[model samples]
Target: MNENNGITLSIQKKKINDDDDDDDLTGCFKRLKKRKNRKVKKKEEEEDEEEESRRDIDNLV
Candidate 1:
């Protein structure tokens, strides 16, 4: 790469790293990874809710 590309990359990296909330960068990364996890689809979530509601009804009965 050219010298300009190196300089620009360094400047962008510094800007991104300078945020005080950089402390939460790891948490942000974890949340992003969880968002990408394929096991959590809407239908599964709905089914879990239905199961929970059924359990509640059984307990009440």
Candidate 2:
């Protein structure tokens, strides 16, 4: 699995040896990724708002 960013999943064949581990792992990974994206977006927005607030305060001074 390449961890260079984005969802780079490698799915093997679902033989008898392949249980629900792959499927479950993939699903969990997707969920975690979605949550991470949301968190990153929120954090960026908060930072931007903070910058804007600082600018406003500076203008008032």
Candidate 3:
């Protein structure tokens, strides 16, 4: 009975450690997603600015 309790406790500890690892992975993925979104948004803004500049030049012509 004592040995069984010890085994159960160890298993529970291992599960806790695994959960922590999952949380860390989730955080890493969220950060990566945010970075990708920022890059895409920046690219879109740059394209918009270029389009606006072209329109201005066309008007001048």
Displacement of residue 2 (Cα, Å) in model 3 is 4.1
lDDT tens per residue, model 2, 1-61: 3564324233333342367777888999999999999999999999999999999999999
What lDDT does each candidate get? 0.84, 0.80, 1.00
Report how far off residue 3 is in candidate 1 (Å).
36
lDDT of 3 by residue, 14-42 (tens): 99999999999999999999999999999
Ten-residue stretch with the least lDDT total in model 1: 34-43
Best by TM-score: 3
Q: Please give the ranking of all candidate structures by TM-score, highest first, separated by commas.
A: 3, 2, 1
Q: Residues 1-61, candidate 1: write the lDDT tens digits.
A: 6999999999988887776467688779888888877456766888999999999999999
Stretches of candidate 3 above 4 Å error? none
Q: Rank the candidates by lDDT, best first.
A: 3, 1, 2
Model 3 residue 16 lDDT score? 100
lDDT of 1: 0.84
